[model samples]
Target: MGGQTAPLVWGADAEGGAPYVFYHRESGELVGFEVDLARALERRLGRPIVFRQYDFKRLVDGLERGDLDLVMNGLEVTPDRARRVRFTRPYYVFRLQLVVRKGESRCGDLACCVKAAARIGTLENSAASRLLADLGAVALLYDSQVTPFEDLQLGRLDALLLDVPIVRAFLPHWPDLVAVEPPIPGRGFYAIAVRKEDEALAAQLDEALAFLAATGELRAILERWGLWDQGQEELLPPGFSGSLAVSQGSSPPAGASPRRLLTLALLAKAALVTVALSLASMGLAVLTGLGVAVARLYGPGWLQAGALVYVEFFRGVPVLLLLYLLYFGLPAAWAALTGTPGLYISPFWTAVVGLGLTYAAYEAEIYRAALQAIPPTQWEAAASLGLSPKQTFVHVVLPQALRLVLPPSTSDFVALFKDTSLAGTITVVELAKQYQIISTSGADFRVLVEAGLITACLYLFMSVPVGHLARRWERRLASAR
Candidate 1:
């Protein structure tokens, strides 16, 4: 940081940063090359450097926002980035390589649709990611340190694009991970970047770098971290990036082949269908539940008794067990009604019906409570004014009951948000379905976390207005009293 204001410095001492910038398997301390290098730079400048340990991608974004004064992580300077940002002297040499899951392989034009069209996720803010962009592949920047590698370890990503040393470092720990060698892209060195205006400071940093290069201090540090070996050569693992026929995935200008694209399209479309069917089933279930509640409250004793039996049975059963009955067992009943052999219904639709019906039982009780809670005198007064019994209930009782139900309705919707996830058991697609897709296809847990967070936020958004209305009605009622 310049003498003006010491902006926070963000770095990730992760990946194969062992003995230098390694990740603690337990407590997660930031160690390794980037870690020590930042401290060394601080000592030379005679200023305290505020180090923020994070993932590689966050460091890059923070740097772009000027939120970070510097990033000393395993960053590589690339041609695309060169035109956008300024760079410090080469910190170390690292090559990019491909990592694939064990027992899984793909075949294609390597440059056209299927090969080029694969969804490759890699660590954020690394040289390998930069190479991915340069190659014009559809590269998804996965979470830093933890997830990028975890996904690779878990079989989520097609393959990970990582540094030569990093790939080597993780290999001993994960026996299933395989690296693609021989055909490494044009080799490049790692560097720290700053905005163009930081040229003055960049010059100062370059001078400091030059001095470090001359004193063998940098090399000593690198050697200590195990980054530098004999003859200044990087420790090469079994794989190399240079020799492989680096199959570039299809770019925007390089559209993927039709079949692979169609597979992905179908994946997304199926998710939509599941959610749509679930919502439709929920709509029907809500109406049926509402009618049953109203009938139980107002209909003749026999009808009320029947409604009670329906509500109690559904409410007593576990949602999952109930769903199984509807999905697997209801075909016979459906066929009996239709005079067919075994009636066929989609699993997604069945899930919607089961979940909605189960929830509706609870909702019906809430609605019943709303109607019953209205003062009996209000109904009597409406009748005294010559209003019909139906008019008395509708015009006088329903409005107050609706207002009374607002808070519980909010709570119900929150419950609904969570219940929707359960639909995944019966094959209904929603947020949970999206999570499964990300898990099976990319195999990343961050997507699940992200989707869960998004769903939580959606519930929060949904609840806010209801909460507001509850408060507003409470105030209105208090004022009238």
Candidate 2:
């Protein structure tokens, strides 16, 4: 347990996890119902509260890893999750809400939305998603709660399914959106979760929650956020609305075979996404790199300087930062400037352009080094043989440079394959993100282990052949020398 001297650290995705935990842009401070609750709990426990930001899907992982003492970011108590984390008594009860553009007729309720086969969007690992899956709805799963609503506003989605409180938080911002007359059927309870082994901390949290409920503090907190409702009114204890019993661990499904076929299939699909993106981006990088190398080596002085700046700027910045700028920032700026609705780059193309351009900078440097390594006398010799500069580059310089750059290029390809995982931040569902979704959705550690192994094997499969080819080329080049 965290003592008075130590901070009570909780995990949250403040950037995307709004209403639950978020940074107030105007005040430059973290403010939300959960933030307030954490502060109140801190006072009760005689410790400072620390909100550690993480991806919503990774919050539990942070708690399990001991990077966090608890998680309070609207985490629902699910059987799968109960297997991994012992949850405190529920502090809030919420339902799934169906949201659509105001006055939309065809798909308002859950039954109608399912009947119409409308394109719905929801958070990937939420109970809402599993319900949508069971209903056989065509759902676009998003990592960020913000994204699906954004898409809904832009008409990219026919409906948005999310927690009731989340919908309420968002309705004030998007006037065109409206929740259905009633929320969806099932209720989800939010609780602070701790690792199952941490019984002492779990007990502390439960006790604190009990005190908050008894004192009317919890009800005040919920009302302050506009999260108090009739369901909550019926659910709290005497002074409050309601609370659920503490959760025990949920064991794996009884009939689950160790075959892991479905898990492998899911991993294979994601691996294909990784491979396709990598290959396409590599192709673009090679073309751009050749152009950059040519410009730096043979173009005018200003062109050479500009080429150098482009290469250095991209190489200096991290790929993830670059991706964020292009995927979120660039499109937002475009939409703002043009006043265009739904005019944004897809995550797929964003990854392709962002990764291609970033890697091109590195590729350019590789090509430049390889180009420079070739004797200047070779160009002179080609000129003496009546070859033009273009002819010399095509027939002489490029051929030799390609061989020289092969080994490093092969390594870059492998690195890029791994880096595609970064696209998950921008909502590209590559192998690593798929693994996260599947493992957490099932609350099965076995899926995580098997998925990780599959990803590793696939990466190795892709790179080993390239490595062998590079070595063979090295031997050939050495023999020629």
Candidate 3:
């Protein structure tokens, strides 16, 4: 599929699907047979191949929705699947095989083993499961291969069912697994698939595959990892020892940024989420911090003392600790108190409360200083004018106090903006969350640098006008005196 409207392909990380195509999140590189084969085919066809990966069963939905042009995972061209989407002509062929402890390879059926009460584990959607189901055999469906591998090694499962090449690639990493007699009994083929309507693309891919096979490139690529038993005329010597590593945030060779070229929309969504949270947090801080500071400053002694304890406890704690206490712990407590399943507040609102309360301690001190800084003469003058204490505070003390603290208040707003990053630990998709996403999903740690760069730029953008206003307020305070 080469047109602008052409569909993209979806691949799966079938465990031991290793070396055929393994995506290491830390490396961000797509590896193995299908990975390399897809790349080579792009070169052959002179068309770009865009690949998205997920678990195999999940891939079927993308295909049905036309989100995928083809499924490139080592999926069998099964009869049932044929009822759903057209499968290409078979390429590499194999049967479902059972890997058991050495010397116990051939068992008539799981019926004999179950009488002995042995456990067998196979992957969900694997051919081994299909064959076992056909024979009415009992087997465990393992979501990940390592679980079954560990169980079989620890003597929990009697056998592991896997296809031949996967078992082959899987063995060197694990020295103990051995294949026994396979149950499906016949060779099936592995091929890149497209919808039947995509027969044109299939023909184009078939020609490329045939050319690769003829040039001995296919067998050669396999032989490097000892997987080249396909009885071809010639084999290209294995060229490289390993798969490509994906490094997030690291600049690509030159003139290419992963965000721009890979998934710009995902990154932009993260940026917007970050900005929205930061602004909301700052707005709440102004409203709630004023109330918190007033409660601490001028309330009854007991009330002031309690507010003091609240402010001091939060201020003395690390910001990150406060973030968690508010986001997670407080929410749990709220749910318990309310007798509801999910009555906790949102992390954004809670963050504003916690951070606002913490910062309000400093604001309380600022208010106390501002109130005290007003000369007794000024209050006496107001009293001589027949003004009450409330009038004196409102007309004379409060305005000067706000002016005195304008600079620090501005700085505090900036601090709160940056602090919104801690919200990501609760799985909020903020700017910092994007860094973790790109670093883990894109498999590149450079996402940190990328996010940092964007954050610093954003801070400059927001801080400049606010900083200008704070300075202007300072100048006004000087002129007033």
Candidate number of the best lDDT: 2
lDDT of 3 by residue, 126-178 (tens): 77777667766668886554456667777788877777776665544445767
- lDDT tens digits by residue: candidate 2, 156-257: 999988898777766655678888868877688999999898888788878888777776677777766778887876445666434432222111112211
Candidate 3 has what TM-score? 0.48
> Which model, 2 or 3, shows the larger lDDT?
2
Q: For model 1, state the Cα shift of residue 70 in Å.
A: 1.4
Residue clash pairs of candidate 2 = 235-241, 235-242, 236-241, 236-242, 237-241
Q: Report the lDDT of model 1 for residue 188.
A: 70
Model 2: what TM-score?
Answer: 0.55
Error at 260, model 3, angstroms: 30
CA shift of 206, model 2, Å: 0.3
Worst 10 residues of 1 by lDDT: 253-262
State the weakest 10-residue window (summed lDDT) of model 3.
248-257
Candidate 2: where are CA atoms >4 Å away?
A: 1-4, 238-481
- Tens digits of lDDT, candidate 1, 253-274: 1121111111233334544554
Point out where model 3 deviates above 4 Å. 1-8, 14-17, 24-28, 102-117, 181-184, 230-481
